[model samples]
Target: MKQYKLDFNSPIGIIEIVGSDTEVYSIMFSEHDQIVNVPQKDTPQVIIDCQQQLHEYFIGKRHEFTFSYTFEGTSFQKEVWTALTSVAYGETATYKKIAASIGNEQAVRAVGSANGKNHLSIVIPCHRIIGSNGTLTGYAGGMWRKEWLLQHEKWNSKGIKK
Candidate 1:
């Protein structure tokens, strides 16, 4: 498969969007030195759309993403990721909740593991999962970024911009 990459400057940090012409593969936070800005003309349309949607999200101008993406993971992980998408835009779920949603309530830890492996980041909304006690938990992008996302969604839910 032909893969394309692009780096986007977001409020939280630099993000790397990777995809093919027809489908997004992953979106991840890039280290300061890892980002390379690809000119718009050279980027695939899907990646450009992902970048634009991300920009809208950061600015609170968009709440939902409309793009095709392909998941590369175990079946169980894909199941967990699909469930993650069902989590409301401005709402949250616990790992336990996600496990239960997948009909494996006892697999909370496994659910967390699958979530940790998610590559789609904001598009998958893994940041929407919190601890059962309503406390924030692990986020690949750092807890501070997770907090920022949760707070951003919270503010957006209330029709207020932060």
Candidate 2:
């Protein structure tokens, strides 16, 4: 299937949004300012919707996204991603909890691995997952971005200034 892409200049950095005409495939952080493959116009409706929702999210106006999205990964990864969505708007979950949630207590490491493989970023809430000791763990978008996102959600959830 032909894929369409759009870019959202978020507070952390430029987020590359990828999708088809019907569902979003992935949203990842871009390290460079260049527009590699995303288009400047003629974006798909799903991409446009994803962009708008992401804008709302960044501004603390949206806590949950309603845009159509699809997961393209292994079943285990999909299960880990699904468990992440239940982490709530301003809450965090440990990898061990996520593994237990999936009825695989021994998959804590596996959960972390699946998180790293997540295609969708903020929408999947992978940044909300942390280490068992309460320290921020690996985030595909970088540790600083993850910290910013967690702090953003904390303030927004409490109606406090960010």
Candidate 3:
């Protein structure tokens, strides 16, 4: 399937949303040092909807995303991603917790690896994953963005405006 793309100007920076007409594939930040892809004029409706949802999320008007997205990764990664959604908007979970949630308490490192492979950014809620010791860990979109997202959700969940 041919994928379409759109660029959304978010509070943190420009977000590149890629998807087909039916489901989103990726939503990542367009790093300043990288060449940003020009958005297609005929952007997919699902992607447009994702843009709207993300905008609402950034503004604290939305907590959950209802956009259609496909997990284009291994089954293990998909399982990890599914468990990630349960981490909740403001709550955080550790890799060990995620592993346990999936009935594999010893796969904490694997859970972390799967989290690193997530491509949907905030929609997947991987940023909500913290270290077992309650410290922030690795995030594919950079640790700073992960920190920002956690803080964003923490404030929004409390009905506190950022």
Candidate 4:
């Protein structure tokens, strides 16, 4: 499958948005400084939509995204990612809770591993998962981004602008 890519300057940093004609494949942070200037008319509709929604999200205007996404991972990882989506906009769940939700209470560490493997970042809400002790845990985007997202959601949930 041919994949299209674009770099978006987000509040946190540069985000590399890669997708196909039908669905987004991944949204990951990028350290590279080169920004592709894909004209709006030339850019894929899915990519355009994803960037717009992400912009809205960063500004606390959007609470949920409507763009379709394709997940690439093992069955267990996919299941874990799906469960991560159920975590509400502001609410969070522990790794243990996610494991139990997937009918594998013993897979707490496995769930954490799968969470770290998630490539969709904020769209998948993997940052909403934390350690069972209520402390922030690993985020592929880094702990600071995770903390910012959680705080963003918390303020947004309360109808307060942040």
The backbone clash count of each candidate, in order, is: 0, 0, 0, 0
What is the per-residue lDDT of model 1 for residues 1-162, given as tens digits with 9 covering 90 to 100? Answer: 778888989888999888888999889999966558674676777888898999999988888889889889999999999999999878999999999999999999999999999999999999999999999999999999999999998888788443
Tens-digit lDDT string for candidate 2 (71-158): 9889999999999999988899999999999999999999999999999999999999999999999998999999999999998999
Reference-based TM-score of each model: 0.94, 0.94, 0.92, 0.94
Best by TM-score: 1
Residue 134 alpha-carbon offset, candidate 2, angstroms: 0.5
Global lDDT of model 3:
0.88
Q: Candidate 3's residue-wise lDDT over 35-102, tens digit each?
A: 35654677777888998999899988888888899889888999999999998789999999999999
**How does residue 140 of candidate 1 score in lDDT?**
99
In terms of lDDT, the best-performing candidate is 2
lDDT of 4 at 126: 95
Model 1 bad stretches (over 4 Å): 33-35, 160-162
Q: What is the lDDT of residue 148 in candidate 3?
A: 95
Q: Is candidate 1 or candidate 4 better by lDDT?
A: 1
Regions of model 2 farther than 4 Å from truth: 34-41, 160-162
